[model samples]
Target: MGCGACMTTPRKKGGERREEFIYHRMDPTDVHAVARKHARGHYCLCPIHGPDDDADLIRDTYKDLGYRLNHTEFFMIRSLSRIPRVVSPVTLKRVTTIKMAERLAKTAARRQILPEHVDAEDPPMRVYVALVKDDIVGWVNSVVADKATYCGGMYVQPECRRQGIARALLAKMLRDDRKGGARQASLLASHAGAKLYPVVGYSEVGTMMVLTPKKK
Candidate 1:
């Protein structure tokens, strides 16, 4: 398969900047060249997705280039109609302003929010924040394409997790998407999310490895 990549420069927790090359369904033979080309003069992260059998080879190739495995995410999907509806105990509101998006990003430890995320006339993404009184406790977003919705950035505060905030957020998002005519929903889930998503009708369809350049 041909390689496809999207580049992003996101700041780490301590204000460190890193460039990421997120590759989707890349061919094994192209891994080394693509990574080396983009890794020059900056800290680089390569999250690669490919055939399951090539996973080990891809990891070894990256290791030789001073990249280490940071994490693995499961690619999951489910029919929107199958997602169970859940009621959030807290309030859920659409994020329609830069201020609201910024707060959600900071609270969720996510990347910076941009205008496209909260555009009034034509927003590319739909974000929902969970509110317990006035405090934003959790958030999720969805991007719809070709009758399918890609759900992501789901997060809840550490103290608020076990109270079903995630499930409620997911259900609300998927329910809205289904009503909007999206038949399928998909997301890349972390280990913790992998366990939770199944409860809302998601099934793992594939896996991807996230790698970062080894620090000196």
Candidate 2:
């Protein structure tokens, strides 16, 4: 099934048309509403809980649920605030750098395989980066389908994890993506992301594994 309303065609079997919803840029006023939804577990976004009321149990809570922290994959907003002042910027930079490198590697890998499909000059993709106190803290990549968007790489630096920075960034993107006339957004999640994605309103489609050829 294709996303008749957006840019790309859907690749799923069921032909079920998942329409994207309204998108708008979230402002400060929206935070309260977002927090409320999170508190109720109805938000379906990550960090899967209300504002950090009990930091001590946060790790235990997820652990009890058998959720393992893909330390690198967890784009936690709460952790953003919890990070010590001295280390936040350094960590954010490391994350941004790794993310950029990964993107480049992925692009290089794709280039080698010319996929009988994509053009040599694939269009430039845009990813959003968010900062706390002017320090890079969170990031997410987005793609278009018809008018809708499929969110790609979403991550927050390890030192900045769990501090609501990611949530804030995501809320902003969802609003912006929708306002751009996108009806829906989707993304594949990592292990730690498994717990977070559902909290922010993403449902699992299935799983995938990537195997790359080793260097000769």
Candidate 3:
């Protein structure tokens, strides 16, 4: 409602113009509203041809939803391993205070990421973050469901990537998953993120296909 705007724009393939709409970012309520419009309940996407490992499909998904692509993500799961590499130089902690959430919100805003209310009173979700002198440089989190533990919300400061911060964050996620009696951990990884998950013992189970809504 208060987060989007619309205007006319030329089509990508032809001379005809069309209305372009975008939701710069969505809160939890906004996410649910889209799902409700789609069907009776939450829905998922199915690839038309197959996984392309490109951003085009994801882009279309945003256009159809009247939202632009903020991140191109892939799907993965943690594989069974005798040992998971423990990366260092970063301390991990679960987000539990408003101060932490405020800091994370600022970081996500700078990155143009979709914001989630990660720090709330008795929050239902858990977010683990990597701290560098009380500043969040990287983090990961998961939501446990009846079927599996879906891990996401992974981010590392631009200057912090490739420094083992992501690896350390994921390792902590897996540890938390096991601690909570979860047997499987899954995540939708961004294109750049695909590289980081594998090092933490996750494998590509399948490629994710993002589809846009059709015109009426």
**Highest TM-score against the true fold, candidate:** 1
1-216, model 3: which lDDT tens digit per residue? Answer: 235433343233434544333333334345435545544322333332224444474455546555433333566877434338686777888776666766776766532112354545433457888999888788676777643687747778899777888777777777767766667888777787787778777787655444334435
Please give, for residues 1-216, the per-residue lDDT of candidate 2 as tens digits: 111111122323445422221111222124334444433221211232223334336445444443333332222221111112122222232112444445433433321111221222332234556556555556765555665566656777687787666655555566656655666666646787778766556666433221111223
lDDT (CA) for every model shown? 0.76, 0.43, 0.60
Candidate 1 yields a Cα-based lDDT of 0.76
Locate the minimum summed-lDDT window of 10 residues in model 3.
41-50
- Candidates 1 and 3, the one with greater TM-score: 1
Q: What is the C-alpha RMSD of each candidate to the true structure, in Å?
A: 3.0, 16.7, 10.7
For each candidate, give its TM-score against the true structure.
0.81, 0.42, 0.60
C-alpha positional error of residue 77 in candidate 2 after TM-score superposition, expressed in Å: 21
| Candidate 3 residue pairs in clash (backbone atoms < 3 Å) | 74-189
